[model samples]
Target: MTQAAIPPFHLAFPVHSFAAAREFYGDLLGCPEGRSSADWVDFNFYGHQIVAHLSPDEAGHRATSAVDGDAVPVRHFGVVLSVPQWEALADKLKQADTKFIIEPHIRFKGEVGEQATMFFLDRSGNAVEIKAFANMDSLFAK
Candidate 1:
């Protein structure tokens, strides 16, 4: 589907602390806050719903899958952004000196569905990926 026609999706994930999630997603990631409750908070993550639900005990889990020679988080979450915005965010992350689990760079370069992507861990250890497609049509191209 074309990027503009791609529908947004809702995502709910466990978090160890609401305050920490707030700081990581809201302050650090720059996602705007939305409806919230004591046990859960929502962020408009690139037009997607990312509700961080309180669950301190579930915070310790970590799993990975080898992808493109890197150990990608098996239970991660993230969103696709326009190319320009993605580049801008990459620059911002660089300026902020963000410690990335996978640094911002092109993946599958010169191949179908070529994309720019970066991965980083949140304060609570949740892995997040932010990616972009030079041509939105190439996003799902195969």
Candidate 2:
């Protein structure tokens, strides 16, 4: 028997400004723009649908938790990419002088669930993480 295909997820997040969201999600992250209105915009985030609603009062991180000795934002979202794609993105982000919350590096090295991960905030202060696994099978190990 074969497993069913994964359905695309839809996420709705708040952004302080639509223009900043456009430049971050649409231009920098390369997520194609889908639809837009006076108060919200939609983006194709790595095959997932994400809508950025303009709500300055609801934007930005409010708390964090420590993980692997790093202060990870309590509220964040991202996608799992291939190692090569992650590396290319990391390089591109670095070249753009992106202020990283946690620079791209290997996590859990020499152990189960080893992966490359990075974290940064958008112009509106919403946290975003991008990660890649050396072995996809290890993604669920331990």
Candidate 3:
């Protein structure tokens, strides 16, 4: 769906340092900086709002679950982009030498929910999974 067709989401996550968050999200991922303060910062994450707060005590992925033979992060969040957008972002991340927890590839091949997916952690260890569906309707397929 188009940005105007869906409601934008707000996510509040923890970060160790605002500088790291700014570099990773703002510069690397190309998210635009929004409101911020000494304790937190917000970014326009693909039209959604994501706030990163300085909370060392509550940061990073804590567990994982097996999915299609890979250990998918249990505590992670990210966005669903178009296939072209996902491919472009994947290339950009690779060029930046971004350490991917799960390298970019197609998941669930020939099955429902098939998509292009990649998982990586920010400098502060916040796990993120960016994915794209060839068919957007597959997002919630059963």
Per-prediction TM-score, please? 0.91, 0.95, 0.96
Task: For candidate 2, write residues 15-126 as lDDT tens digits.
Answer: 9988899999888989999988998899999999999999999999989999888899999999988899999999999998999999999988888888899999998999
- Comparing candidate 1 with candidate 2, which one achieves the higher TM-score? 2
Candidate 3: minimum summed lDDT over ten consecutive residues — where? Answer: 1-10
lDDT of 1 by residue, 65-91 (tens): 887777888888888888899999889
As a whole number from 0 to 100, the lDDT of residue 25 in candidate 1 is 88
Whole-model lDDT, candidate 2?
Answer: 0.92
Worst 10 residues of 2 by lDDT: 1-10
User: Model 2 clash pairs?
Assistant: none
Candidate 2, position 58, lDDT: 92
Candidate 2 deviant stretches above 4 angstroms? 1-4
The per-residue C-alpha lDDT of model 3 at residue 65 equals 100
Which candidate achieves the best lDDT against the true structure? 3
Candidate 3 has what TM-score?
0.96
Candidate 1: lDDT of 50? 86
lDDT of 3 by residue, 34-141 (tens): 999889999999999999999988989989999998999999999999999999999999999999999999999999989899999997899999999988887888
Q: Which model, 1 or 3, shows the larger TM-score?
A: 3
